[model samples]
Target chain A: MSSDGCSSPSGPRAAVGDRVVPGPGRAPAGTRQPLVRFDSVWKTYRTGAEPVHALRGVSVSVMPGEYISIIGPSGSGKSTFMHILGCLDTPTSGRYSLAGTDVSSMGEVELAEVRNRRIGFVFQQFHLLARLSAWRNVELPLIYAGVPRHERRVRAMAALEQVGLANRVEHRPNQLSGGQQQRVAVARALVTEPDLLLADEPTGNLDSRSSADVLAMLDELHRSGRTIVLITHEPDVAQAAERVKRFRDGRFIDDGGEGR
Target chain B: MSWWETMRSGFDAILGHRLRSGLTVLGILIGIAAVILTVGLGEGATAQVNSAINSLGTNLLIVSPGSSSTGLVRGGFGTASTLTYANALALGNKRDCPDVAAVAPQVQTGGNLVAGTTNWSTQVIGSTPNWLQVRGRSMAIGSFFTASQVKTDANVVVLGSTTAQELGLFNPVGQTIEVGTVPFTVIGVLKSAGTSSSSTNQDDMAVVPVTTAQELLTGTPTVSNIYLEATSASTMGAAGTEVTDELLALHGITDPANQDFTITSQTSLVQTASSVNSALTFLLAGIAAISLLVGGIGVMNIMLVSVTERVREIGLRKALGATPAMVRRQFLVEASVLGLTGGIGGAALGLVAAVVVPHFVSNQIAISVPATLGSVAVAMVIGVVFGVYPASRAARLAPIEALRSE
Candidate 1:
């Protein structure tokens, strides 16, 4: 099933800005069971005209505590993979298991539980509720997890502190900079302590400085044994992870990131 | 999510769009207030009808001469001299009309009362001494004339309180008063029955003996009205029938429809008045229902827009693990909150208008607890009903597609 092309990782990418924190190296993927596994996943969407194959027979696995990035241009299935990884969408034909639980054919309610307990997502648009303060935004996931108010506050504060946004807890989205907003989103994702953190174009809307800052923040998270799956179109942003997997036309071109 | 959290978030969502939410609330406000006012007015009208009928005394019926047709032109009831004092006396006989307790025959005329040179034009009614008992009237001063007074054609007049006041007489028993150039001694004054909604003044007439009125004034045997009191309240219908049969027999009309007089009962009068009142109330209530429907549509329209505008927010919430039920509840709660706020505001406004409007309008606005509370409940139900589509629409959205939408 291997592509048998160049199994070499790309040469070190050019830095877009000054990187504050060094990325922790990849965890050895062969020793323990993978936290996420996708077996021949396929997603087909039907419209008035032709059925679009957003993902076609893509197979991959993400080991626990490993940081990985999927790189692809627009319409190259990377975003689809991120959606499937976050349990926001299900594969039309495939087995998708998160933490050894098969969730591919689960109902919407079960998917929601998985998304709440097992997956956390950072969107390209930051997706912070415009009306809520930073801490309020961070505590949202725990709210859905049925956490009590006092405990939700405590965990949300800890998540924000981990993201180095402890001081801007009361500031709303509009009051904070784009980097701070994205960091607050990351804190929200982290507050649930999910098994997988899926980031879809996390720095897409930011300038180079902010992008570097968010990347460094992600790097610090990865160093602390958090499993992260980052989707990106830029080579430099993809380089923030220890491993990079390229995708095109709904198929992942394994550049030897899948250890045999 | 807990209901408290859902509710807090729903309230927060409404507060986020104050102007839009307020405008939506205003629609329901006007609808609820209009409904309340119309209901109050209808009840007030019914109450007025009831009180007016009750003031006419219980178990009584009036027999009036039917319309007369002369050369193709017909007059209204009481226009023909078909009723007489003999018919009234016959009704009072227990063998002829067993249900009839007491009968008063009266012939009325608009005449001037002159006492101490202060002249007042008022109705002069000629009736028997039983008029007071039949009409449920009591004397405020002096004594009513006796049966011997009617037999002797005595010119003794009993003034109503308003007539006595207008004619400059206080305690004018044994006083002299001129009834259209015929001098009469005032024997008593009737207590007032107070002002009513009808144009007829109940306390502005004078009563005298029928014999004296006919001899001294009309020179006619026809009487205007024959008031009959039933033996008991339960026999009112029987009493009315007895009076009609007696009058028809007395007039020598064999066919019931060809009778020359008409019997009027308080029950029929109240029924007719209240029917008209209820029809008006129904019309007003229909108008209010339309407004309420429009208000419900307004809530739906705003909720649809909210679902559309916050598509991304909804997706984000779903991605954060909110169930479809949770999303639906949130929107429904928001709609109910709007409806409840508007309901409270409208109820307050309507109750205030009830208190303050009676001073300006002639009719009282009765306070109705059921209508008030029922309308508020209806508003909330309207919110929930209209919210269903929009809330489910928000709930049915696929999280990925919603998040991807701009």
Candidate 2:
């Protein structure tokens, strides 16, 4: 049912959904450097007087154009892991790198630049600004990137088209359905063409049909030689990935094997 | 992002909350309006007083008797009769004082005037034919009493516009009116001179020959005051000094301070009026400026509330690659727009008040250009000054924490 072993091993190959043809197969982890690296990362939260250890000495790595899922129940540090990987939050201690850049020790400004250029985040809530139109929401990242007005509009429209929402460009969030809103958010994330697409429960708030649609879109993105790291507790959602890492009580219990 | 786009987005944010922004702007509007209105009214009052002082007489001087002190029981100026027609004649001599233009000696007293069944209380001023020339007055009807009429002590008088109106005589020339139980023929009616800078009505007196007043009305030969005009405004100081010296020599008073006669010039009167008006203007404007400070505080309060309310928006923007500086610029621009709108609206309101207020008040109210400009500038400054704390607070917010604020 899944199109496994079809991701391109080379840098940024074009992907046309089911029509996409596989390139030279990726090398094994032992023979190549990874695009994402985490060395014994720990995340602690000081809510009040006592500290809660969210992530305890966890380590993981991801390669380019690889689809992976990090699955865990609530309080298993899965969300914290996604936050650190997206550069939204830093580790309490230990080194982390993305696209060969050390991001663990970066300041807020530098991290923000790294997040803008290298990462695209899709949240469970869809996080589309309610006031802006669908295309305007998609154009937001380009605006921050200092893209000129005409080019930002063109690229935003193109990205919306990629998500099959070309006719809903002028629709506001409230005017669109849940699945369409998620698609618009996906378009927003894709507009920047970042190296990593980190989705934290991208379909958690949608109905069964909408959730299926979002999951299928993510699978299609993975088939198109795009990197996707989806965080979810649903087995059905995680099963779509080629590989999976299971987390329990802030520790990874199972690192699924790679396959071709 | 570019500064233009940042400003545009900030304006959009401000527009999103119209009622809140409007109320905030109203506070600043009242403040700026108060400042502009007060300044306009003050300027108008000062201008009115200055023109009134100018119309009193051109380069004229009034020499009146100083106070008489009887063992510290002092009597006010104009209470003694040290000035006389002889001193006036001496001052008017061309060889003695070429700077002196015209001289009109006068003795004044308040009395009742009766014509037919109408009666009015008015000031009766005794003077010569040169009264019109020295006082800068013009005859509206017949001529003034000639020199021969003054020497003969003719019972002829010239009625001022107000006095004529009071006596119910529009054309008073050749009409008879009783002054102190003696019938006097009105030879002329003086044109309206309006009011003085001191706010006293100038056209409420009747003028008669000085000899007629001394011999027939007051029954005394002692004159009370002398009016002298300089040939040119530039020569007033020299003319004043010459008149004082001539009076002192005539009266045999050596010390200048102890001289019984005192000389007051038009220039001094104008200077005094201007200084007093300027002080009043500053006081009024100062009181009005306090409201502007309060308006600034209002702006700061609104901005702080806005920053607190938009924490999530701030987080979203920060996540989208906006720098802390960019965030600060956005809020600052929003605050400035609020202030600019309020300032311009208030200035327009003040301009309307400047035009409309004169209809209600006795004095003219005028909008001063500098004050209008300054009020706008002050509003802008208040915006920036109050906007900083809130903008900095928004800029310093951590993205993760702010996003979690819901």
The CAPRI class of candidate 1 is: medium
True contacts kept of 2: 0.55
| Candidate 1 structure quality by residue, lDDT tens digits, A1-260 | 12213222122121111121221343333345567767678899897599999998776767788788889999998888888988999999877778767888899999998999988899899999999999999999898899999999999999999989889999999999999999999999999999889999999999999999999988888889899888999988988887788899998775535311
Q: Model 2, A105-146: lDDT tens per residue?
A: 999889888878888888887877777899999998888888
Q: Report every candidate's CA lDDT.
A: 0.86, 0.83
- Model 1 regions lying over 4 Å from their true place: A1-27, A256-260, B67-76, B139-148, B168-175, B185-188
DockQ of 2: 0.54
Q: Write down the TM-score of every candidate.
A: 0.91, 0.85
lDDT of 1 by residue, B1-406 (tens): 9999989998999999999999999999999999999999999889888777767677778888897656667788767898878877888899978988888998888788899879999998999988888777888888889989999999899998989998889769999999999899998988887756453777999899998888887899988888888989899988888788777787777878566678888788888989999999999999998999999999999999999999999999999999999999999999998898888888889899999999887887999999999989888888889999999999999999899998
Error of 1 at A242 (Å): 1.7
The residue-by-residue lDDT of candidate 2 on B1-406, one tens digit each, is 8988888887888788899999989988988999998888778777778777766678899888886555657678767777777777788898878899999998888879999889999889999888888888888889899999988999998888888998899768899999989999999888888764347778888889998898877877777788889999899999988888888888887867667778999889888888888898889878778888888888999999999988987887787777788899999988888888889999999999888877776777787898899898888888888899999999999877777676
